[model samples]
Target: MKLSILALASTSVIAISTAAIGQEQDEELRFGLGGAVVTQDEGYKDVGSETQFVPAIAIEYGDFRLLGPYASYTFFKTDSFELAATGMLRLDGYEQADGDIFKGMEDRDMSFDFGLEAEIDTDFGEFGLKYTQDVTNTHEGYEATLSYGLPITVEKGRIVPYIAASYASEDLTNYYYGVKANEATADRTFYQVDSATNFEVGVSSDWFFGQNHMIKADISYTSFDSSIKDSPLVDKSGTFQVLLGYVYVF
Candidate 1:
């Protein structure tokens, strides 16, 4: 399985997803460092709310940006529209070492995904569209996502409330949640997952101070579709993840 460079932000990669487009500024390099934590409970039968601390390292140079496991390069832009090439790592699968529920299950490997994304900003809000495919045959699948966010300028910073939906292919869904015939046990049944759509609602905020210091926090809830919920491996219907961090812009 391919390793993800970082897990500093939301596994959904929305830290860099607000506009899905980089800010329009003079060609310059920007960097920040901090630490973040995430807490999640995503339907895994035996898994409780899993939390972890990750170092946050973000870099933006000219038309390129890198944050955690997500990276993008903006090649086209306009006053209210922009397009970019993006990539991220798939960290959805689990290993046997993770828990007994996966004791005899074949390991579902992670993969790198690459795609093109477009963003549109209007008085009402921002809209982002993306289509990605797993380059590695690990899952041999593709997915598409559509998201909307409303940015409310606040004191010295901004807050964004957003909603997003992603459609995953059968291959992708099955790879992460399916139970194979040979892998099934007395308690686990052989199950196959079809294409599924998941929905998410989130709010993210940022506070700026002392010229270069910034603090950020984000919270989100994701609802899985029936296709995934029916999996014996899953026990919950939804999941929540939270992220908070501080950094000095330089």
Candidate 2:
């Protein structure tokens, strides 16, 4: 009787320990830095789509992801499934070059986004679909993205790379650029925003210089397609940008 009781206790402990280990590996917190060179298409001659710098930080903990102070979302998890809810807000201003269409006017824009996501786990990797709704007057439209993730190489280093792309429509592009009639100044024309899409490919890496201190680099190209091509908001062709920065994770 004594031997049987001891055996039963040992089995239960082993089962509990195994369950805990499995759960630990199911979720992870992945922190990374991203940089990109973004270019906007023509029609914004006044804004002269110049090369601007973009720096960003992202943190993923369990089912929650946070970007700067503007975007936050909660995620759901299944055996190999995922879902999420997201919200975002941002403000931006641009300077125009001389001889540009909207040269005399200042370029200022603000936008807000709220959305949901669904993802599936595949043998190749993780695939996801996302939908976002613009809430602010600066951008009042809907957009979506189909994303995928796959491991390219196994190497010894601090940097790992990946690629992503998104497709947007007229409503989405205009919301970000097409100012309403009342929104535009007296001298400026109510330029209509045309349909456009953006394609982006980039790589990201993490450098562990020391304990509690690290460096990161993200570089990519974003091409914007919009009807405001010859308008006052942007250049005739498009705009490009390159961003570089550093961070400390505690």
Whose lDDT is greatest here? Answer: 1
lDDT of each: 0.78, 0.49
Return the lDDT, model 1, position 219: 90
Worst 10 residues of 2 by lDDT: 1-10
Off by over 4 Å in 2: 1-62, 92-107, 119-123, 153-163, 179-190, 209-211, 226-232
Q: After superposition, how far is residue 209 of candidate 1 from its true place, in Å?
A: 1.3
**Pairs of residues clashing in candidate 1:** none
The estimated TM-scores of all candidates read 0.91, 0.61
Where does candidate 1 stray beyond 4 Å? 1-25
> What is candidate 2's lDDT per residue for 119-200, written digit by digit as tens?
7887877677877777775556677777666534333224434444566667766654665676467656676777666554
Q: Looking at model 1, report the run of 10 residues with the lowest lDDT sum.
A: 1-10
